[model samples]
Target: MLWTLRSPSVRHLQPCLARKLSFTPNSRLPRITKDAVREIPPSTSFREQVARSAAPKSFTSEIKTPPVRNQVIVFLVGSFAVYSIAAEQCNVETAKWTKKLSGSSLIWKVREPTSEELRKAKRLELGRKLQAGLSSLKDMTEGWSQTMRGLAVWSYIQVFQPILDAGDGKRTCWAIGGVNTLVWAAWQVPKFQPFMMKHFAHNPLSGISYTLLTSMFSHRSFLHLLFNCMALASFGKSSGVAASVHLMKEQAKNPHGIQETDVTWHFLAFYMSAGLFSGMTSHVMTSKVLYPRMIARLTSKAKPVDAAAVAKTSETITETSEKTILPSLGASGAIYAAVTLTALAFPHTEIALMIPPSFPIPIQWGVGGIVALDVIGALRGWRFFDHWAHLGGAAFGAWYYNYGPHMWNSVRATHLEASQKVQRPEKTD
Candidate 1:
């Protein structure tokens, strides 16, 4: 009879009754009323009845209050997240990639430094100097003054003067000016020479290796810097270096305009990569072939020994001379690369020579003549400059001019596809 009760108020008691009794209603149990249900003990063993008693008396009357502990936890978490992001300002992702790809600790992974990092580095340097010895406060101040002067002059000459005087707001001039400033600084500072030689020059014999890219900005000879700067000023602009005719045509035909900044970034990547490729070529030749041959020739001449004996003697000489560091540093390699690319892009364009018989010649003809001279010089072992480097640079320019664009596009497409796949949800069975 209780099971057949139709009162909606008694529905809450159904679960408690089900737990207390079997499938059949018990005859001994008292009938349930709203008042009787309300009178149920708060500490009841029956779960439903305990839950009903524990529930809020009124949903609207309950104050909206958040836990202080929860608020404190969320604030701490948010602050930590912000701190982590800020701390990663100098993220070394590119450096890590370079190190991983090269598989060499000899070559330093280089990146452009920010102002904060530069200041910190200077502080460290000054602190170390202070710890070494204290000559005089006056002397320290003077030294610091000189350093500041040099830095100010360099920055003014490179980044500011060009922008102010050129009257043209182009990214290329700023880049060129900055490089020129570095070249000038490298030449002027005696300390810089040893630093560059040890760390920046790509010498297989040297323990330090970042010189592959740094060498592109190095030029000890004033004439060399002048020549490279002239060539760069002529062709380093966006109009000349940023895009090929084919790229320009595509941009023109497309509805959306391509960003010039992207092109500039791509050109920078090409230039740095070209320098590394050129350096690698020279390193292989000097370390593996040229150095050994020189040793062999000297060994043979010294004793007039048998060929096998001479070879053995040369090996001995090489072992003894292993400590000798051989390094080639200059921007000629990268400069030649730019020249080759420019010539290939506009074969009909005329280039003027700085030396005698100075006349404008077709770019293709000029580049060919220069390349031929380099090839001859390399074979003959001319030590005036790195002819092998020139050849390597030329080869890189040609290769990049042909396949670089396609490769870059393909890489970007593949990356975009991968990202899309990751973002898309999986299908259900």
Candidate 2:
């Protein structure tokens, strides 16, 4: 007996089948995805339903080639990147993680992570580590510049708060203060510096170093201030301020605390170290054949500019030749460190760059990529930007973070010792 076929299209339908059904010639479903199908009940007219829904999901099919997942990917990445860079550039904290639930028990039923979710989480974890590493690098920044940086940051925040709340002169504006903060940070650099220096000096006894912490108020220009203020409107204007104040209070309590004294020392250290590391890395690569003395010599004279300048001069440098090079300026060193910090803090977070934000990169990968790039820069001594500074700052940030808890403990112990000494009767002269 011969059985009659219901419809060849039903069994024969693959994503390849969508091609014949699709109206446009070069466009059809590429994957035979299960998501395209709904219910396939026994009583239902399954064949006709599949044909109808199988029609491409379109917003305006005739007018355009309809949006695809690729478009969605691009949009998500681009928007995320712009927000990330803008927020980071201005020193505001940006979003990076999503709330998630994970577990193995059905009785304790947990939300299973989708592929995108898992991918993002892994990226976030990686970013967090790198960012911490960057914080360790601040140890390398010079004192005055770091203080200037703090002032600039605070000023931007102050401007930002008021601007955010001004609300086109209508709604109760939250961003107004942030705008004010930026304005203050930009114009009042000198005033903030004295305060910065007074508060952040290093310990004489504990081998602890110090630098001014008011870099909270520095900005490169009016544009920098303006943009930072705008960003402060969205994120709370008080983030870095709170951190700075807390450090200051702690310093007052424990003179040997982690913040710093000789406000220019750490910043200067970072600047020189970055250049030095960059030069050393570069020398090692070119020298090919290893010599320990040569490496140490290169490292000792490692100013960022000399690292760059050394390439043109003879690779050989005597001790006498190192003294003449000029020192560099700018917050780029610490900024690079901060960039890495934000990247690691929110690795799963997305980033969109300025100039061209066609897409966003995952924060974790972004941090890795930038750090990797900096490493390559150190070795090659690229002239584009100070890759060594970036690496140096990142390294400093990580070190500081690791030492943060321990440093605080040391400060507390010193405080206790001093307090007991104060309570004890003074010896008569």
lDDT per residue as tens, model 1, 205-261: 553445565666777677777777766666655444322333333323332221121
lDDT of 2 by residue, 271-346 (tens): 2332233233222232332223344455555554554575543344333222212122223444444344445444
lDDT of 1 at 363: 85
Instruction: Score each candidate by Cα lDDT.
Output: 0.57, 0.39
Candidate 1 error regions (>4 Å): 1-170, 240-261, 302-326, 354-357, 419-429
Best of the candidates, TM-score: 1
Candidate 1 CA-lDDT value: 0.57
RMSD of each: 30.3, 33.3
Identify the leading candidate in terms of lDDT. 1
TM-score attained by model 2: 0.31
Candidate 1 has which clashing residue pairs, if any?
A: 200-211
Candidate 1 positional error at 418, Å: 3.8
